[model samples]
Target: MKAEFATAERAVTLGVRETTDGLKMSMRRQVTSAGLGQRMANTWRGDNYPKGQNSIRAAGVVYTKASRIMEGFEDAAVIRSKDGWWLAIPTPNAPKRGVGGKRINPSNFPEHTYGRLRFVYRSGKPSLLVVDNARASYNRKSGQLRGFRKASDRAVSKGSGLTTVVMFWLVPQVQLPRLITFNTEAKRWFDRLPQLILKNWPD
Candidate 1:
């Protein structure tokens, strides 16, 4: 939500011999960067998707700090640091009692909803791949304990008949990233720039 820019010194080869038309490449770079930033921002906002885009559909860690995109020009982008971990977890709505009124363990539930976690990094170094259950819920307000849910105190249950049960617990679920789509969209945005700049260029 805030406008922030992080400068990344990338080696750019304009790919053309020196000429009076160097402006074309420079314009291309700027437009490309802006396009990429907008695409990434849209993804973060969960736009341009259909059918339960907000649903948590898998269990496990899908993203970490290292996987974060590090820089953008007009929108906020993740800054690389040895200080925190970002995790994606999938959680389902709730589960009901099975046969014989037996309480099902939350772990056995098929996770179809997703959320994310941000963890504070400790020690002189931090890891991007270290996943420990004890450390996973290291956040003070993560997960559930006893009969208390950290996210919501109200108990809600779904389903009816012999499948009715109370909604309980939250756990990690995973969501896949659309890196390919990001690249495609970014390229499409960038592809239109030449004509745009030519139209704006002085006669």
Candidate 2:
């Protein structure tokens, strides 16, 4: 007599689906633990280190709006101005973004609000946009300069405790350092994928 074996096709399919779900869950947990979520939030909101939302997962892919920034931290990258002009690196004295997220530059800076900005050239060094006779406003608790106070005509004429404040530093390019071990972190989680699948195996 001969014996024949039949495959449990439905059970096999269910097992595979369960394993996939578990792997996805594990990946989401690992990504959250990596602190990328907070980084993305900070980048988007222009805030200093706050709790962030979870990463977006779609069709078996994980990503975020700050993905390019995260990738830049994986390796040294050079950033330059898009207009072939000097990059305007903001200083403590620079005004914050204007209405509608418009960048405060020399051309568009609200002169009425912060006084006129003057350009200062330096030999073999980055140039600067400065405000004369202006005082910097600082946070009382943090002591961080928020913006420059527009100096009155009287103050400029009298030079009454007046000071020059650097608003923006103009540079051709800036180099970013490798700040994150992206591949290493991903590999650490990837190596454990088999375990994740096994743990999720259907009963």
Candidate 3:
């Protein structure tokens, strides 16, 4: 697969202080284009983690975004995000039916994976969330559907013993911003759209 991504500078810190809308926090955004199976990896890899360090990203997002180095290797950091939502840059790897390691049902994919999206601004802050029936974003080719992640897809407890949780973007509305989603079958945690999870990963 092929991917194209660009970083955007100059993000605004909307609420670190205050706002006309009285919204709190900051908003940073950059547009990226990933080929069918590319762009899964974050732009800032290798610089931090070693090669083939991709699988870890998925495990990490199950917790939170922007990991901060809490201990262990300098690369080991605590995940964090500015907005109420978590922001993570998953390292891209090959696609598969099961993840980390587990079998899955062929149905309940994009069709039933995501749906019932709703969004609104709290305290004048512009925010949004999306509901996707697509458990995971799959290449819309004829036979490639299965190649995409299925609802039954899973990330097995590995040498590290990490649980593979999925993450997806929320519904986007004109009054609200669209939450960008990542992960195949990442919608499993859809009910708790932005309920930030702090993962104390063993380094």
* TM-scores for every predicted model: 0.22, 0.64, 0.17
Sort by TM-score, best first: 2, 1, 3
lDDT of residue 109 for candidate 2: 74
Superior candidate under lDDT, 1 versus 2: 2
Q: What C-alpha lDDT, on a 0 to 100 scale, does residue 106 get in candidate 2?
A: 67
Residues 1-203, model 3: lDDT tens digits: 12111111001111111121111011111113222112322322212122223222222122222322111112333444545453322212222322324332112223233333334334544343333222434466653433223233333222222222232222222121222333222343332222221122111
lDDT of 1 at 72: 33
Report the lDDT tens digits of candidate 1 across residue range 1-203: 12111111010111111111233333334444555444433333211112322211211111112224422322344333233423322223233442345543333432222111223344543312211111112345765532212221122222211111223322232233323333443454356534443443344
lDDT of 3 at 60: 19
Off by over 4 Å in 3: 1-73, 88-142, 146-203
- The candidate maximizing TM-score is 2
Angstrom error at residue 20, model 3: 54
Deviating ranges (above 4 Å) for candidate 2: 1-59, 99-103, 136-147
C-alpha lDDT of residue 180 in model 1: 30
Q: Considering summed lDDT, which 10 consecutive residues are worst modelled in model 2? A: 46-55
Query: In every candidate, how many clashes are there?
Result: 9, 0, 27
RMSD of each: 20.7, 8.8, 24.8
Please identify which of the two predictions, 2 or 3, would achieve the higher TM-score against the true structure.
Answer: 2
Error of 1 at 105 (Å): 14
